[model samples]
Target: MRSRHVSVWIDAPPDVVYAFAADPHELSRWAAGLAEGSLRPSADGWVADSPMGQVTVQFSPPNTFGVLDHVVRLPSGEEVDNPMRVVAAAPGAAQSEVVFTVRQRPGISDEDFDADIAAVTADLQTLRGILEGQ
Candidate 1:
């Protein structure tokens, strides 16, 4: 399995950032690629929809952390199930670190992996802006 981790330090409090991350509706608010999504009550957790596709929550801890059991179907019709986790850490009262870790399945080529990385990175940057009130 291939993995990618991206993190950003924000000027908001941990709870503030955590709250934003925890809310499914807020995801589309910050995530540029997510055109629409909603939180559904399910055995796994919440499920969301974006322009790229849909993802279901496999694990979540209240308002502080969560993981999305994501499956991305590329334009070529190749589907990859990447499990991603979002974590929030507060080292200071006024600062927080938001981290996203993605574990990709085998069979994805280097070029595809690079493209996925770029897309995720861009989404993280957008998340940072929303959380920081920028």
Candidate 2:
């Protein structure tokens, strides 16, 4: 599988950024590519409407390592793993870098892969704007 990492630098501490990004409730504010205002708590995770239809999103447990990995189950019963992270740009730095990794499945075309990358980039930009109060 091919993967692309889309990132944004937020002018906030890693912990702050991680707290916001790791919360499924905050996804409506910045994760336009994944969920809008349609996210709600489900029995196992969160359910949201995506371009592809309804999806179930399950995130990794909160931890100090800043890992925000998640699995999104599509309407077609396929699950996609989304790897994300929030880390200090530099040691002891106040700023944080948020990275989202998008992976291309075996049958995806180049154009589709590019569009996926673009969507992730836009989502990260939105996250930065919200976090930095831009």
Give residue 124's lDDT in candidate 1 (0 to 100): 75
For each candidate, the alpha-carbon lDDT, in order, equals 0.61, 0.90
| Residue range 9-75, candidate 1, lDDT tens digits | 7777776766676666666676655435554556644455655565554434463344543444444
> TM per model?
0.68, 0.95
For candidate 1, which ten residues in a row score worst on lDDT? Answer: 57-66
Clashing pairs in 1: none
Q: How far in Å is the alpha carbon of 84 misplaced in model 1?
A: 6.4
TM-score (C-alpha, index-matched) for candidate 1: 0.68
Badly placed stretches (over 4 Å) of model 1 are 33-45, 52-54, 63-91
lDDT of 2 at 112: 95
Q: How many times do residue backbones clash in model 2?
A: 0
